[model samples]
Target: MIASMWSLLAERRDFFAQLALEHLAISGVAIAVALVLGGLFGGLMAEHQRMAKPSLALVNFLYTIPSISLLGFLIPFSGVGNVTAVITLTMYALLPMVRATYTGLSNIDPTLIEAARGMGSTDGQTMRRVKLPLALPYVMSGIRSMATMTIALAGIASFIGAGGLGVAIYRGITTNNAAMTMDGSLLTALLALLVDMVLGFVERRVGMRGTEGRATNRRMAATFAAVVVVGALVGVVRALAPATSPAIRVATKPMTEQYVMGYMLKDLIEHDSGLTVELTEGVGGGTSNIEPAMESGEFDIYPEYTGTAWNAVLKKEGAYSEGLFDQLRQEYADRLGFEWLGMYGFNDTYGLVVRREVAERYGISSYSDLAHVAGQLRLGAEYDFFEREDGYRALCDDYGMSFGKTMDLDIGLKYQALAEGQIDAMVVFTTDGQLSTSDAVVLVDDRRFFSSYLCGNVVRSQVLEEHPELRQILSKLDDTITDEDMSAMNHAVEGEGREPEDVAREFLERKGLLQ
Candidate 1:
């Protein structure tokens, strides 16, 4: 595994290097911003003793939120990618910095403050001459700690469509590539250690300076200023950078098929049209996160399912039908200013996947049949499935199912649980790779509880107006991918360890859609 990791790193050094730079830039900007704002706030808290309690309580509460949860909370406000990442990182970095400044300033000896005042030092002068110099070491300690922590936490940024080493980690896990995962994990650890060591050196110097002459203090201050200035410059340049031509910004959910399809859109659009495609794959929270982003024009294009777009994005209820496809498109256009185009000829609808042995024992071949035996079986499903409008409760209600027990499992773990006899049944998608080979039965949705989810591209209408050719380019995928085709491609990545792009390109080539 170590050998494999080394080879993968060497092979993808450029990719890893870009990710490392992105990781550094994100952490650097976040820490720099936190340092400025948190130091100001914390210093104020120290000066006004009454404000300290409430201020500390607020920061403590924010700091206590789980990283993933915090990112989810920030998505609607900050949108996704580096903006969301930097915001979340800055929030988490604030507590350490604020607390450190407050602690340092509050710990100053009263006699020293009095002595400075008696020596004709004004309040500001006393703070600069006595309080601040004495507090230097503590502030430096906080910066050091904040920098190290931010870099490590930055890995979570990739989960929300940000660029970083975390992308490698997330992609590696999704693709089942152990070497890629190792590469990302090891590099992140090394980065944290490296930053810690460098900061430790700076901290020791700050402590050693120890309230030196005014000239010496100014020099130390300049050193800190330089670091913050550089980080801020990096962020400004990135934010202001403009593309020479309008690029198609595409986003995709955190699923194998979506990743493959995202690349397919990129490949075909770039091949025929004189346009560049910027693809952000594996967006966290899928439609929930990406929908708002699309509505806000943060994303110009993304692949979405008809049913998921209806139930999840539109927040509609009741069973969907082929008749509603036009209604769905119309609602999207009139309400969201989006276009639903390029319906890929594959129905990746939901299903009730039962253990073959259990199904055979219960004589169950359909949802209605399962309902009769449900009281004796346990069902395990992904957590969000229970929360989704078209998910667990609705399906069960439609089929009159009453399982003996229900377990909320991770999406990745439900299949394993079913195979291990920990769950007699679990929800699945028609294009699930395991369905192609597993000795399990996908009970018929006799009641049509689940809607058919024909895959398609959801595009910003404004973009389509600018690039009318994109409509033709995107429609090339219509009637192209079949159920078996999508399942095989998904299995190629998740099961056979092939890259999603490689699988997508191969399928496109076979279909004569690409050269």
Candidate 2:
């Protein structure tokens, strides 16, 4: 595993380099912001006892919120990507920073301050010459803790479209690629350790600087200021960088098929409209996460399922009908400020899957056929599929299936489990890339238990208005990707181990869409 990870890193060295830099920048800015704010707040609260309890309580409360939830909450205000990542990570860093500072400052001897005052020192002089030096170790300790957390949470921020090491980690997990997961995990650990080491050096320097003369202290302070100024400048430039014209952002869920679609859109849009396309793949929460992001202008377009938008985004209940498409488009436009483009000539609905050999041996050609032998077989499914209304419970109840054993497996690992014979059957998507290569058979949904999940582009209406030609550009793909085409494309990536970009381009080129 280690060798494979190292090999993958060597192969994708440039990509990993960019990801590492982004991770560092996001974490660095967040820690810097937290230290400044937390230091001031901690100092004031140390002197003012009454405000300390409530203020510390608030910071502690913010710390308790999960990183993913916090990022989601910040999306509406900060949008997706670096801004939201920095803000959320800063919030996460506050508790440790504030607490450490207050503790350090309060622990200093009152007699030292009295002695400084007796020497005719003013409040500023006393703090700079006596109190601050005494509290330096404690404050530095807090900064150390905050720095570690900022780096770690910055990784999690990748779920919200923030570019960092977390993106690689999540992608590896979703793709069931052990090498990719190891690469991300290893890099993230090294980064955290590196940050800790740097902070430790600074902490030691601050502690030792007390013995130096005024000249030395002045020089050290000046150097620190210069570093801060440069960091701030770099941050401003990144935050304010203008996106190129005729540009649109594309996003996708954390799955092979979604990734394929995202790349396909990037290729087609860039080729047809001569526009710049920035694609952010594997957005967590799928459509639910990406919908708010699109509404907030983080992403201009993404492929979404009509059933998912209805149930997950719009929170509608009950089964869908044939007219669902038109209603969904109208409601999305009128209420959600988005528009639905053409379907991609396929329905990637949920269904049962079993090995072709197993299906033939058991005479289980359909979901209803599974009922006879369910009690003798083990099944695997993803957690989300287990929890969704259209998922496990309804399917079992519809088909009257009661498997002898069931396992809630990671979405990425489920296919491997099924292929290895660890599972007798598993929940499968009709359009999964693995379906073609794994020799798995999708059990017919004879009872029509699952809803139609028509796939298409969901774009911000404002984006369409701004680039009016976008509608035509997107429509070029309408009803072009049939089930067979999707299956082949998926196999090209999952089975043939091809990059989604190459597979998407090859398909588009074959279709003459690149012309």
Model 2, residue 155: distance off in Å is: 1.4
Write down the lDDT of every candidate, Cα atoms only.
Answer: 0.87, 0.83
Model 1, span 310-383: residue lDDT tens: 88888999878778999999999998999988888999988888999998888999989989989999998766
Stretches off by above 4 angstroms in model 2 are 50-54, 209-224, 234-244, 314-316, 321-323, 354-366, 369-389, 396-410, 416-425, 436-441
Q: Model 2, 424: alpha-carbon shift in Å?
A: 6.5
User: What is the Cα-based lDDT of residue 72 in candidate 2?
Assistant: 73
Report the lDDT tens digits of candidate 2 across residue range 1-515: 77878888998899889899999988888988898999999999988989999998899899899887887788777877889889998898889989998998899989989999998999999888888888888888888878887787678877877899998888777765668778887888899999899878766665564546556756988998999899889978976897566679999988888888898998888877868899998887676678888887878999988777777777777656557877878889999899988568777877788887889999998888988899999999876677676677777887898999999886678889988899999987787777766778878878887788878999898988888888887888889888878877777766665667788888888878887
Model 2, position 390, has a per-residue lDDT of 66
In model 1, pairs of residues that clash are: none
Question: What TM-score against the true fold does each predicted structure earn?
Answer: 0.90, 0.87
